[model samples]
Target chain A: MNNSQDLPLKNDIAARFLPLIIGLMVYVGTLCFVFTLFILSATHLWENQLRTQITLEVPASPGASSAPLQAQVLQVLSKTPGIQQASAVPKKEVETLLQSLLGTTLPVDLQFLPVLIEVSLNGREPIDIPMLEARLKIISPQIQLIDHRPWQVQVSSLINASVVLASTLTFLVLLTALVTTTFATRTSLLIHRQVVEVLHLIGATNEYIAKQFQVHALKQGLIASAIGAAFAFLTFIGIAALLEKAGLPSTSLSSFSIQAFCVFALSPFVTGGFMMLSARLTVMRGLRP
Target chain B: MSDFIAQFVGVGHQYKKGAEIFKGATFNIEPGSFHFLTGPSGSGKSSLLKMLYLGLKPTWGSIRLFGEDPLTMKPSLLPLLRQQVGVVFQEFKLLDHLKVIDNVSLPLRVRGIEAKRSYRDARELLNWVGLGDSLQAYPATLSGGQQQRVAIARAVITRPQLLLADEPTGNVDDDMAIKLLHLFEELNKMGTAIVIATHNQRLLERSPYPHLTIRRGTIIRTPKRSKP
Candidate 1:
């Protein structure tokens, strides 16, 4: 609020702690970048669950025939209450999905891939997998049911761990920022010792000196945070472009809601508040009589 | 509650890991009076002054400032009292990073005084001290006398009720030292209490004020002088 004086607030701080600030910005930026990725992946996994709940496979032994079994499985799925749609995925589609994991060139011909029937369910009712499997067995003795719960659990766990890891990294970044601000504040105080003592002599209160530091650091940290957030956004766009070109799953890391966007916008503000607190505490403690 | 601004009774102090420095020292500084504290090196003059400034507590006995006991004063309230007293240290202690004007204006700035007004007043004081042209110069580039003058300007800028100078003229020549002394005297004339600690006999001889002489850890005597 005191504007009687103009401080080269950003310029002076950048000059004094250029490397540290840059490093902080880059570290936060990278975390934000990865956070976006995790959010997108989590959303994709949720979307996948909403779209496909079950997979039915049929074996192809010497005398086995999948065409009749596929028809029977589709007929059973259509009668189920929660079942919305059922469709047979041709052999080639399955082979293509396996190609990524097995190799570009699979060992056998494309027709050799197992016949699969994808089942999508609707309405909020949880599917009874055991009953469905039992009813599905009456259609074909060779039918195998994959409810996708196990895979969903695995994906959810991975997403949860990723989120927890990102949150932990963000916490560590804040701690580092506090430590960094403390050191800078101490150095600044030592450099201004005479000024401080002179102010003390002039009857200037300790709170007044501490305010200057707090305000100055708040500005510094906000600027660094803006730079970091900007970098994060740009990196997100670059990664999105890379994934698009690679023809990978079209997952989106963009802000999903106002709240999500606000959280991103507030990153710098939170960082600034932390730096202000650390600097103020450091200055007062150093000047304590 | 009386008119006395400061009172020290049976005060004693010592540096850690060192012998007792001051022993049962006693003094009183009235609301608006100029006094000089003189002592040789190792005579504990700085230690005694530190006690007066509340920078160090007396090892024994009681001291009072502004009618309040310093021994029991809360840390939160000490700054309120300290801000009413100005200090000029022996080494000048000017911050090297700030320009001369900024250095001179620091006390006012620290007091949360408006910077424009503080700077305006600081420039005037610097002009008064004959260092107006050095306003933008850093302390390291200025002569020792100029730095001391800046220090003096900073000390008086706040218009504190009590001004303490510790060998302020130690780094200046005879003429500059006397000029600095006169500045302190001028502030004293305006009813700001002044205390100057120095070993310079010339300044003592030139000024006409009561003097406290210290030897070892105690005040040897107090002398009254003819009016300046």
Candidate 2:
């Protein structure tokens, strides 16, 4: 005798399974959205770190003291308009970097070690890398200027691809949820066709009948979406904890901005609206003469 | 409002891939008048009642209820028109999930009446139908006669301008049938038109109302016989 629901939708098989399926879909969708956000933030951080830095390599020359070549390159870099600071990388530090890669230590006086200079730019104006390279080449044909632009481009492409993939996955998850709701609503209509006809005979409007289904859908949808979002949040926490334990950075991946939290909070209501709309449309169509 | 609660003109109906059930059947039901709709099995008794309540539209013809042609009326207005008519289906058509009281109060709830008032009225009607104790019982748990009483309570709860009953006395005993007849008479006395479709010759013989008998896909009106 619950006046709120005229139909026995609570006993429905669809009612039992709809929340679970919708919850699973919402979980995947939330993860996809978070991952896209992570990738975007990580890309922005990497860009800021790489944009103002360049590397210059002064190759070793046999029977030539590279000190003069290194000093000459440093002088040329200082004369450049946009260059802020340039310093030669110590040989021991370079040796340690190579040792980490090759897993072997070199002799202290290995004369074949190239002279490396770390260059920092002010980033206020664009630097013509080819012009800078030509200036450095005048000092020695072996000098090479390497800016981070190419690496940044590759990283940006990878990030863009990840974002596209995540977006597509989120879209697919929502579409599946929508289709599930539609089928469930249609099945309910079929199962309760006799009850619906009785309601009609008793002077009930189609809107009246449809409202019952809509209310059922909204209730189920809201509960399922909340459960899904909560589970997704737990997953985010777990992943972040795992990443932290593994000695990796998890801030961008695990931390939610205000906008992200808002999106997550709004997901349930949005999903509920879609489900209610689907139920309403299905009822209207099923009841149509 | 129109003097006639419902009017049918040259109405005909058929199912898909089936022969016409009834054709060129025309009749007018005046306010507060009672009529017995009698017909042989499969004689379209149910179909005629369906058209009366706007449950089924005739394949061809014009029908008016509350002075509005249901066929030409706005679809949105159909429920408002239907609100003035009530039907007791032959199959009982009770929602198995709903309790007896809920089923009886359904018509009022559909009209957006407050539950407190609707349930109070439904409870009083159920008591009159001898279902006061079974108010909390589900339809599946009720006997056929009890369910029929529940349907009757639902149809009359609104005090609709017209009441259409199909085989209303089919599942009841002679005493309960007479009681139901008296109940209909009381509603008719209150200016609510009534139509009871039945095959019970005894009830027909006992009643003083005219009969609209469906004969060979046509309706034939028979005036009430004078008491001996």
Candidate number achieving the greatest TM-score relative to the actual structure: 2
lDDT of 1 by residue, A81-173 (tens): 788788888777777788877898658664445578788888566777789889978866778988766767777678768777776777676
**How would you encode candidate 2's per-residue C-alpha lDDT over B77-182 as one tens digit per residue?**
8999889998898998888898888999999999999999999999999999999999899999989999999999999999999999999999999999999999
User: Lowest-lDDT window of 10 residues in candidate 1 chain B?
Assistant: B219-228
List DockQ, one per candidate, in order: 0.34, 0.56
Please, what's the RMSD in Å of model 2?
A: 3.8
Q: Candidate 2 chain A — worst ten consecutive residues by lDDT sum? A: A250-259
lDDT by residue (B1-228, candidate 1, tens digit) is 758788888888866787787878788888779899988888888877787788788878889998988678776687788877888877877767678888788777766787899789999999998998888888999887788888889889887788999989888899888888888888888889988898898888878888877776777556667766
What TM-score, computed on C-alpha atoms, does each candidate reach? 0.78, 0.85
- The worst-scoring run of ten residues by lDDT in candidate 2 chain B lies at B219-228
Highest DockQ scorer: 2
lDDT of 2 by residue, A195-270 (tens): 8988887889999999999999999989999999888877877776786797767565545445467667888999
Give the distance in Å from residue A47's predicted Cα in candidate 1 to where it truly belongs. 5.2
The TM-score that candidate 2 achieves is 0.85
Docking class of 1: acceptable
lDDT on C-alpha atoms for all candidate structures: 0.75, 0.88
Task: List the candidate 2 regions with Cα displacement exceeding 4 Å.
Answer: A57-124, A139-143, A250-254, A257-266, B1-3, B15-20, B223-228
